[model samples]
Every structure is written in C-alpha cells, then in structure tokens.
Target: MELKLDTISKHYKDKKAVNQVSTVLKSGVCGLLGANGSGKTTLMRMICGILTPTSGTITPDGQSIYQLGEDYRELLGYLPQDFGYYPDFTAKEFLYYMCAVKGLSLAKTKQKTAELLALVNLEEVANKKIKTFSGGMKQRLGIAQSNINDPSILILDEPTTGLDPKERVRFRNLISDISKDKIVILSTHITSDVEYIADMLVMMKQGEILLTDTPDNAAQSIVGKVWEVEVAAQELRAFEDQYMVANFHHEGERVRLRLIAESQPTENAQPLTPTLEDLYLYHFQEGGTADVSTD
Candidate 1:
C-alpha cells in the first residue's frame, strides 16, 4: 500500500500554505515535524481528503483518492489537530457513535467500542462524560475514536498535545504497535513525539518539506556541527547571538549551551551527538539547509 503525493500545493488569497511538495508514503509511521504555520495541517488535511489541493494530485497506489471517493475514505482514519467531540458523550458512547457513523454493524460497533476504550486505557472512565474528563483523557478518547474502524492509513495531527510524559510514552508505544502493516502519518511540533517511534521523519519549513529520512540518518546531517560549551553567565547573550542555540542550562554561575554551528563557536566548545531536537533546531534557523541524507 503506497500513498503518493505529486507536486501537491495549497494556496490562500495571498499566501502559499503548501508548496509543490511530493513524497511517497508506505506502510509505516511517518512523523511530520515542523514549526507552527509550516503547512503541516494543510498537508495533512489534503492527504485525508478533507481539503482539496490547489494543484497536484494525491493517489493511493495509482488512482486519485478523490476519484476513489468513499472507497478511499473507508480505508482512512484521521484525528485532526482540533478534534471535535460531543461534550455530553461518554468515552464508550463516543466510540460507539463513531463506529456507527463509519457504517459498522451494531455487533461490530459494540466490539470495537469495548476494545478501543481498553486500548487507550479509557476503560476505567468509559462511562464518564467527556466534559468531565481531563485534557489528557479527552485526547486519549479522541485517539480511541479514530481507531474505531481499524483504518489502514491513520493520520494523527498533534496526538500528544495534552499528554504527560507517561501518557506520551503510552501513546507512542501504541502507535508503534499498530504501525506494522499500516501507514501512520503523525504531525506534531514536538520532536520527541516521533524521535523513537517514527520509521521516517519528514521535516517541513515555510510551507515546504526540508528533509525526510530515518532518525539516525537524519541526525547525521549535522554530525560534528552540534557543540556544548560552558560560558560565564555574562557571556550567555553573546554566545546566543553567535550560534543557533538548541538548549541552555544554568549551572550556578555558569551556563551550559547546546548550539549548532558550522564550526566550534568558542574555544572550550565540545562536539556532541545530535538528537531530533538538535536537527529540528538546526533546520529552522537562518543558515539551515535541506540535507536529506538517508544513506
């Protein structure tokens, strides 16, 4: 099952939300990482068939999804960035309603409702109203609803918004478990969300894909470019002005800075390994360039 995008673009009155972006997605988890307003949502909407592209075509295998119509949607499950829910509906009720809407049989709906609730660990509050649930609980319920149909292509937009560290880990593990034979496109600003779970990392910037590769392979793009340096508190401002700082820590009177630069930023700078956050920060800064080195 291959999903292909051919020069897909989306434009508003005066702005181009998505450039002529083209990529082939296969059966595995593809993490869409980008800063705010980077056209991640627009691209995801187009892929889910909720929004038509200004140009280009999206096809599953060889036929356009629009042409396939219901046949295409039947195989998709999308959890939007802003998922709407009935405030009065309980977790179980919401899943049941979603299953019914997806055109499942009553027996099948019941079975899925029970299964999803447990899968997301919402069984304890299966009968609690969504209005009374916490933010994390609501997010979990939204994920549960999306999986009611057991879709082959699952699209999740910022699925870890309100989750704590523990919940985030649980959600990541869940997605990893289900992505074996499925195409999962997860869009989020959190790099850690896709750091270990995603088989492919797609980085976007200014309405265009900047890089796409495996995690280990992508980090290699900035190999020997990330540095860690300890500077006096008074030098922090100058250090930040000189490099693309990815992280900073205050250690008593000194500051530890993790930065990205073409070469060492200071005499005491030590080369360090690059992580997803380092790569993400490196690509978003002024001197960042698209270097997709998969091999």
Candidate 2:
C-alpha cells in the first residue's frame, strides 16, 4: 500500500503552514522530525482526511482518498497529539468504546480490545480508571485505542511525549513489530526515538520539508560539518552565537561544545560523527532553513 501527497499546501490567513509538499509514503515507518510550529501536525491531519488541504490531493493507490469516503478512513489509524478520553473509564472500557465508534461488531470489539490492551502492555491496568494512570500509561492507552481497527495506515503524532527511556524503547519496538505490510507515519521532535526504527527520515522547517532520506544518508549530510571545541565557560555564549551548537558539556572550569558549521570554528576543533540530533540542528539553525524538494 502507498500514500501519495501531490503539491499539498495549507494556509492560514497570513501564514502558509505547508507549502507544495509532496512525497510518497509506503509500508514501513516514516519519521517526521521538526521543531515546534513546523507543519508536521498539519500535514498529518491532511493525510488522515481530518483537515482538508488548501490545495492538492492525498491519494491511496492512485485515487483521491476523499472520494473513497468512509472506505478510506476505515483503513486509517490516527493517534493525535491531544487524545481525549473519559477520565472515569477503565482502560478496557475506553478501548471498547473506541472500537464501537470505529463500527466494529460487538464480538470483534471484545476480541480486539483485549488484543490491543495486551499489545500496548496495558493489560495489567486494563480495569484501572484512566484518571489514575500515569502520563506514560495514558499515552499507551491512547496508542491502544488507535489500533482498534487494525488499520493499514497508522499515523502517530508525538507518541512518546510522556514516555521515559525504557518505555520509549518499548514503544518503538511495538511500532516496528506491527509495521510489516503497513504504512506508519510518526511525527515527533524526538529523533532518537525513530533513529533505529524508521525506514526514512523527513525533516521539516518553517512549514516546509527541508530534507528526506534514510537515517544514514541524513546523518551523512553533515559528516564533516560537525565539530567539538573546548572553551572557557565565560566564552560559551559568544561561541554559541558564532556557531550552531548541537550540545555541550562542562569540563571542570571550561565547556566543551558540539557544533555544526561549514568550517571549523576553532583551530583545535575536532570533527565528530553526526547523529540524528545533529542533523536536526544543522537544518534548523539560524539562516539554515532551505527547502529540500522531493522532486
């Protein structure tokens, strides 16, 4: 299965949220990485058929999904950033409710809800009221609800918002497990969460896509552009102002900085391997947002 975007655009009164963005998504995970205010959410909404695009069409298998009507939505699973829930309902009841809303039969609802609860590791708390769940557990419940229909096209926005390191890893593994023969578009600012699982990485900036490639290729974009330098703590601010600093650590009285630049910013600066975070900062740094056309 494939989902294709053709010159898709979304505009507010004074700002273009997405501009002529076009890409073909297929079975596997596609990670949408961007800073806040980027058009990731807008683009995802358009694909899910929840928000109509200002221009262009989203198609599946070469036909406008909108024309498919309810058929198109039946195949989609979307977990929005702010998922609403009945605070008093138990996890099992919440999923059963979602199943009913998705038009599942009474028999299938029971089977699927149980399966989804186990899939998200929420079975232990299946009878606990949602109001008592931790943020991570609630996020897990949200994930479970989205899969009520076993959709072929799954869209998740910031799915790891409240998860800790271990939970994040588990969530990534769960996504990978269910991604075979399915299209999963996951949007998040946490690149590390998708670094190992995503088949492709799409970076956005100022409401436009800036880069799209495999993780290795994306990291390669800044191979020789990443550097590390040590400077006095007092010079840290000045150094950061002069370079795109990805990270830094204090060493006794001095600070070691990891930055991205066209050339070494200091004589002693050493070239370092670029990670996904480095790639993210490299594109969104001051004066660095350039549109990377999918064409």
lDDT of 2 by residue, 1-295 (tens): 9889999999998999999898999999999988878999999999998899999989998889878999998789988988999999999999888888878899999999989888989998999999999877888888788877778899999888767777777778888888898899999888786687999988888888888899879998888899999999999999888888777999999999998899988899999998887787777776544222110
Residue 61 CA error for candidate 2 (Å)? Answer: 1.2
- Model 1, 133-219: lDDT tens digits are 877777778878888777889999988876777777877888888889989999987878778799999888889999889977998
Give me the displacement of residue 39 in model 1, in angstroms: 0.7
Candidate 2: list runs displaced more than 4 Å.
Answer: 287-295
Cα deviation at 127, candidate 1, in Å, is: 1.4
Sequence-dependent TM-score of model 2: 0.93
Q: What is the lDDT of residue 14 in candidate 2?
A: 95
Evaluated against the true structure, the overall lDDT of model 1 is: 0.86
In order, what lDDT does every prediction score?
A: 0.86, 0.86
lDDT of 2: 0.86
How close is every model to the real structure, measured as TM-score?
0.92, 0.93
Candidate with maximal TM-score: 2
